[model samples]
Target chain A: MFYDRDPWKEQSMKSRTSLKDVAREAGVSTATISRHLNGSLDLPEPTRMRIEAAVSKLRYHPNPHARRLSLGKSDTIALILPDIANPFFAKLAAAIEKAAERHSSMVLLHATFNKSDREMAALERAAQNQVDGVIFITNRAPEAKVARALNDFARAVILDEDVPGGKVPRVLCDNGLGGVLAGQHLRAAGHRHVAYFGGGADLHSTQTRLEGLRSGLAQNGEPAYEPTLFVGDHSPTSGRILAEEFLRNADQETAIFSGSDELTVGILEVFHERKIKVPDDFSLISFDDARSLHLFAPAITSVRQPVDQLGERAVEILFSDAWDQPDFKALTERMPVELVERSSVAMPANKKKRPEKQL
Target chain B: MFYDRDPWKEQSMKSRTSLKDVAREAGVSTATISRHLNGSLDLPEPTRMRIEAAVSKLRYHPNPHARRLSLGKSDTIALILPDIANPFFAKLAAAIEKAAERHSSMVLLHATFNKSDREMAALERAAQNQVDGVIFITNRAPEAKVARALNDFARAVILDEDVPGGKVPRVLCDNGLGGVLAGQHLRAAGHRHVAYFGGGADLHSTQTRLEGLRSGLAQNGEPAYEPTLFVGDHSPTSGRILAEEFLRNADQETAIFSGSDELTVGILEVFHERKIKVPDDFSLISFDDARSLHLFAPAITSVRQPVDQLGERAVEILFSDAWDQPDFKALTERMPVELVERSSVAMPANKKKRPEKQL
Candidate 1:
């Protein structure tokens, strides 16, 4: 009704024939014509030629917009990610694209760069576009307003990290398990004092992983000391700054647990420039083995996020019909993470030559 | 006319008030209300509150799809790229997103994975979506059909590698200069016998770079044998296979000119595994310094592809008002490339210990 006076629609209607007309011209079902044009159908040579002839004669332009408008779904999902340049997010996007293809859905990318305003703007655009669903990812503590906006979506999935107040299905890597694996490995290597380089301290992932680290550190016995916290955003620049801070302030820390490969890159850059060797000057374990860590100078020890699984599961959850169930909206699925052992983890330099002290 | 009997339209129309109704209720211009909702305009507190109240009271939903359909243009651009997992493409996507934001356009990402069918599918979808424009990027030499499909778009800009039959304006990095730089650097270091690892032999970029390499290598004299060619897709796996083939068959080559950082990564993996030392056993230089080449094991030397400039120029060309000009579609702009010297190149092993013989 609103488009009754629209000039563009008037012009388009006068020029192009509809899918129904083409189907009738070809003496075939409308679904067949639609599928053939969509490149999703395998028609016989004669039938294909007939449909082609009908399309050409009738000037039937296949506009998915009209069909999607009528269906009340655009068959697209908005992927609002933090930073695409980060190898981790890049890998995640690639995996999501592959998985989304299985659902015959397209992904509209919105890079928020971890800025609050950009995040809100992306959400508004997604709403305006009438995307069928949204997958929201953030690297910092999002504002409550962001969560409220997310809650408005009929189908939204909070991915990779948490948004405090959003009531939506979440698919995230097991941060707790990742921390425990790092802590247990560090503890076994005789590392008593350690530093944790991570994103903002208020983030759900940061807090959860910290708690897991403490539990694992105490599993063997009373820990020598509480792991020190070095807070910053999950970015290479932040990592470089954090590494400088750690190097300047650290007194007895024998090892470090990095929150992401992004931070690890920064730390390594500073270390390489300063001639500080991993597992020699300080044993280190990084999370998010999404980068080519195996090829780094001293092959890195890292907690490998199941990036493909995490991405695939998020799409699977978003498209599931079970969203109507009361509990589906409250679901939070944590995929497991694995510890990849390489040369980065080793006996603490201070303890390598010394015998165990008597209790 | 097609939607006169559409049931979904009837339902939406009955439940939701039009933008005009909201504007009337708020006693403001429709443009003002629309801009406010888009978050592109700042209004006085009272005016904003009034518009918000009217939106809430009337339950007016701002559907960009409907507005776009009526306007005959969606404020979105389709980015058809080869692969997103590759750091080069990932960086390109990020830059394009930032640039598209300046134009208030969203980017719809479609990863073709260098598949012809997927490329055509993405192009068709872009047409069906009525996107404002398209930025098509491919790594390989595309088939003629792809070019024909691209030509059908009202606004399309070819980016990165060349498509043989594409008539649209193109934004590409200076591949010939990239080759010349690598070739000159190797020649200066006394690497007369070098191998070129590239993508398809038919690719415009690959061939141009190879030609430049030959010129650069022959700048001193034409005594050395012609450079050997090892061709495959621009992928790490392909690089590994090519490297293996080179190692198995090579005799005189003492240096390598790699086509991409992706290929360089694979070569390093195989070299690291085989205990072949860079600049010691062989010299190397890579193209597309999009990855973290500076932090690799040996700090690889590379030819940087000016990724940001390339992406920004593509978007700029796509949105340019020069499309009406007869010569606009024939435009092909090549951004300059820069060579970043690190520790990859060295003199040939045999020549390292001996002085050059007098002619």
Candidate 2:
């Protein structure tokens, strides 16, 4: 196969000079040369100069594979996310890659698609490759084993959402605040009853956002009613399914807070098909405004995550010198999010009297 | 400091068995064992069983680094792309990653962001890593040196846009066909004078699409007018600039064939800001329906690239056994594109007679 004669093999064969050759010419042990080259040893000036001259004379370059083996570092970070095709995650990956580059590191991407087995496999592979660190992003609430696997890494940052038992620092958008903003906006627009469409009820973001929604809906000392919950994965398909259920079982709910733009797309698709008007029949607000929501049919109202900042901060935290600090691993950095007001939200429709039941 | 004690290093230290250990135990040469493990050597059943038993008894595991050095294959593919943040590229990458996984190969992503230096650097890094193959994707026309660097790879598949000097298999959507579809759609709607928004005039896609557009616009028994070209990089910002330029220089062009949805977003933004209506003021058609175009304010008419097929085919070719064939390197696979009709196109507006020259 052509791969058998690859440049690495050809170069190795063409250039026969090895560390032993340099050591022989420098009149030093191979160990000394290896240690010196890897910066693990400090030799006298004359000896160092002799080794350098011999290395230059031989034109010997250290094998990267061997160097990696010795150093136990790959100069790479692994980005484990749900799906790379998802615009939100794609944008996040781009930002993480850019930030990793600034630190002279490359990113190895793994799209688990929010699957547990895939997540475990990706983590194991990252460990096997001895990556410098990992930035883990999962949409679903992960199993304990997944958290354990993540914790096994020397450095890993849980990003976008939380992992229940993950000991690593987390960088996430303020989901509660996002919910609060959405709730306040809905309440101000004269919406009292609303539904929260979430990925999973157990997800930290979902719980926080729901809590914030309740708090924000409370107006002028009135007791806040818990918004109805519709749980599904953070996908457009799930959005479609949830939207259907919402329509079929809607009970005076006048607004909805979609968990992600992905779901929002699904909801809108069904609505558009069914001729359900937005802000008239139902007001909506989506999270993770990563898509071109501004160009949507009615110009979607959304709670915008600081995606760029979240990704950048995750990488920064992974590579930070403060990893050795006692509280660093337990730290959680919640970047702020803001509500983008567009034409999607409006006052609820006029109440209609219900007819008496007839069998 | 934590990197130095990575689990791989710890494991390596705990298990000192090498290929030599297994070879000695099996009474076979190291080369035989290596070749057997790599599936390069066919051995009798007894010998194979003996080797397996020896390996298990000695608990010998091949060092991935050493194995890579010996085989000259990294079991990894490098995907060099312009940008991952772009939906088109992101979708393409997702498909490629999924396909590559089927072949038990991992993808190392490199986002060059359409820079010559970055392209060169990524290629060099891929070479250094001894990747099994490379899938190169660029938006702009690359310099000859970049092509040369790409050519140096044992196997590379030029994807999406063309690299003129690259001597490798290519997998790209039929840009000319896409243009023709758009042009025909517009021409049918009574748009004789049209404009093209391209990434760059020198780009292969741009030239091919322009050619197709000209052909499509020239219907039977009708004269064809060359569409005015507004060139810019495939970005929303560029779209905005080009739209402004098109407006400033508007003569009689009644429609636009935007190169990509990225550009379409920018044009729409500018048009929205200026209170211009699509299909009312000017008909429009966008290329690369990777974004959620269906939900756009006025669902955009676009040419859809077979992104999934393009990505899957690229990986299939990369790993195919046909490399030894003489014609394989010269292969160019052009996936067909389809025009997705929506409400964005309409008949040209009735012309208002210009005021008689009073000057």
Question: Chain B TM-score of model 1, please?
Answer: 0.86
RMSD of 2: 4.5
After superposition, the stretches of candidate 1 with alpha carbons farther than 4 Å from their true spots are A1-53, A56-59, A351-359, B1-17, B20-24, B27-59, B221-224, B351-359
The list of candidate 2 runs beyond 4 A from truth reads A1-62, A351-359, B1-63, B351-359
In order of appearance, the predictions have TM-scores of: 0.89, 0.89
Clash totals for all candidate models: 0, 0
Candidate 2's residue-wise lDDT over A1-359, tens digit each?
43434544433331467899999999999999999988789999999999999988986767667777787667788899999999999999999999998887888878898899999988877765667889999999999999988887778999999999999899989999998899999999988889999999999999999999998998787867679999999999999999999999987788999999999999999999999999888999999999999999899999999999999999999878787678999999999999999999998877543442321
Q: What overall lDDT, based on C-alpha atoms, would model 1 receive against the true structure?
A: 0.85
Displacement of residue B318 (Cα, Å) in model 1 is 0.5
lDDT per residue for candidate 1 within B317-337, as digits (tens), equals: 888867767899999999999
For residues A221-316, what per-residue lDDT tens digits would candidate 1 score against the true structure? 665467899999998889999999999998778899999999999999999999999978899999999888887878899999999899999998
Clashing pairs in 1: none
